[model samples]
Target: MGLSAVPSGPGGEASRTDPAPPRDVAGRGAEAARLADLVARSSRGHEDAFSELYDLTASRMYGLVLRILRSADHAAEVTQEVFVEVWRQSARYAPDKGSVLAWMSTIAHRRAVDRVRSVSSEVARDEQYAVTTVVREADHVWEDVEQKMDVERVRKGMASLTAIQREAIGLAYFGGYTQTQVASLLKLPLGTVKTRIRDGLIGLRDALGVEE
Candidate 1:
């Protein structure tokens, strides 16, 4: 059939037309399925599958480790350890348990935590403290520029907060005190400390525009 022309509006201009949006759902589903298949194959000693899996997850795993350890060198070391462990334990992964990404995150978290604990222990020992003297000195230098800026921002944010809120946040994050420990340190009731921490975090999140 011959098409009929629609009448133009106002200044004889045709109305603007919008194009259909691209569909990403099928692509994402295919990628997920591919990763699952790769993981399954890697478990059975498929080197190509293992390499592909590593390529997919390495950046994410390294970023996770770096966030926890806060040191590039340590993050690199832990990332290497994580992939080594992943390769060794690939056979232990069960499809029923979780996604491949979740399994990788769990391993990365454990290794990063272990590294932190190990460093803490070494720092606690007097003999090894000397060996870490350089680390301390470097930290002092770095703190003056980078950390000082962070501290100032935190301090400014704290200044905008109630004294109790600032206290709660300081104890929890800087002092590494748990809610119970924070309560103990401040000689406040545990419930009060909990409330303060919750409120403080909310305020900080709002102030910093952190996504919930």
Candidate 2:
């Protein structure tokens, strides 16, 4: 049996194969430029411009909050607080310091840290499992394969440190425990905990090639 030819639509002609339409590249560029201008104006107390800036940056700011907080409920709460802070402090942002995204990320980072620390020590002790869950989730979010590799590199750089120094730093920073808390948890002297944290930070600063 011979294969039947497919029928064309309408005209007695072969169907035309249309090429994909071109994207609105210039439009996107113009929109981004407009948003940047709006943010600049908003930073100077222009209410409408501030609204537009909020629209542009809110999702990105939320993503950062979620990554750090790891609880959708807490993240949402923090996201609102972050924008409120941005609206109040917009005038303090200096373009020379960094881009809008960086400034917003910095704000989110500080706020997340503060929120994490504000959980009272007693509550934190009682809710250790909850804190561990949040930290594990945050590690999954922030330390993907690439970031894990970077962490390994950082660990290698701190190779000169004794096990106690490494553990002290990890508990204080990654575990979000205060020095006194770390000492209590590790059953170490308070002074020893302090020395380990300070020395470990100095060692890590060198290992990670961070400047003073």
Candidate 3:
């Protein structure tokens, strides 16, 4: 490895060599071919191929999911979900559209986003559940059906907001936390948390067709 000079900054980061630069494109093509083959075999129910594929990519995919999720347990769970989907849907991969790693990472990122959305929706559903619990006089059958419908609506509506907005609003409104508390929990500025909550609620309202 050789060092390369970079501009000095407050952190004073130093020069770094880009590894495998000489064969970067060729290496990627070869790697893509290898992974595509593995995916194809895995799709055909080859246990060995799937095992090798996991060995080659699981760490990278887990790291990517962890960064997005910021929770070890959630990240681990979603990482498994991503891999399971990959094995199930491997036949759907099209190299013409992108490289193998690109396809895998896309699945990982989407799964991570879904996990975030699910958490927020679960919070909203919990609130609705509490309401249903308090209103015990209602017909049990209709109440259960209505509760399910409401939770489904929240799931659909929450998807429209950005992940951060959904999370902030969930904490404040559904999780029963104040805006200040949400800010503290998310480690964001109070105004930013407030704005996310506002924007998120507006989006949800529009999705649910709430007037005013």
Candidate 4:
């Protein structure tokens, strides 16, 4: 429902103010391999491996959901749903497609986004019905139209970003991750992630016709 920072720890646990130490490429690869193996085992009905997978990833998944939903209770429930999907779909995971963490993050992002859109759709329906029941002032009607146009403009602007830039911005803004976390997830350097976000925002501002 809103964007909020959720402090994350090394293993993606939330509520830790300390920044996680950076990992070398080899270290990241090792972690990815570990997660992938766990997934594979879990898919084969290894209960202990599934439990370990939950332990390793739940905190980070919860943080991501919390950032998008801005509600701890909803986040917790969604996090549980995410892992259930993970368990059910673990066999479908392909190491060739991406890291296990990335796979799980995608699932989390989609589930959270779906929840937000569901709520938004319900609100929009109620508003539409209400509109037929009450007459609005001309100016208020114009304001509503303008707001809808602005939202459309913003969506178009986002479509203008380069794939990498769009992805970085999505993780940082919509996915509720810090630049550092984005870099970690993307396996890019911190500075590179910062540049992408900066350039992406500039592009979006220009698209919106906003002056510096």
> Which is better, 3 or 4, measured by TM-score?
4
Candidate with the greatest TM-score versus the true structure: 4
Stretches > 4 Å off in candidate 1: 1-27, 120-212
RMSD of 2: 13.3
Cand. 4 Cα-lDDT: 0.75
How many angstroms is residue 172 displaced in model 1 relative to the true structure, after the best TM-score fit?
Answer: 10
Q: Sort all candidates by lDDT, best to worst.
A: 4, 3, 1, 2
Instruction: Give the lDDT of residue 14 in candidate 3.
Output: 31
Root-mean-square deviation of every model: 11.8, 13.3, 18.0, 17.3
Q: In candidate 3, residue 101 scores what lDDT?
A: 80
Query: What TM-score, computed on C-alpha atoms, does each candidate reach?
Result: 0.49, 0.47, 0.47, 0.51
> Which digits, one per residue and each the tens of the lDDT, describe model 3 over residues 1-212?
33445454323423224431222333345677899899889888998999999998886698676555555666677899999999889889887887678789888877776665665633332343344344434544565554556556767889989999999976654344567878999999999998888888889878765322
**Candidates 1 and 4, the one with greater TM-score:** 4
Number of residue pairs clashing in candidate 2, backbone atoms closer than 3 angstroms, sequence gap of 3 or more or interchain: 0
Per-residue alpha-carbon lDDT of model 2 for 23-53, expressed as tens digits? 2233334555665577678778899988888
Question: For model 1, what is the C-alpha lDDT against the true structure?
Answer: 0.69
- Clash pairs detected, candidate 3: none
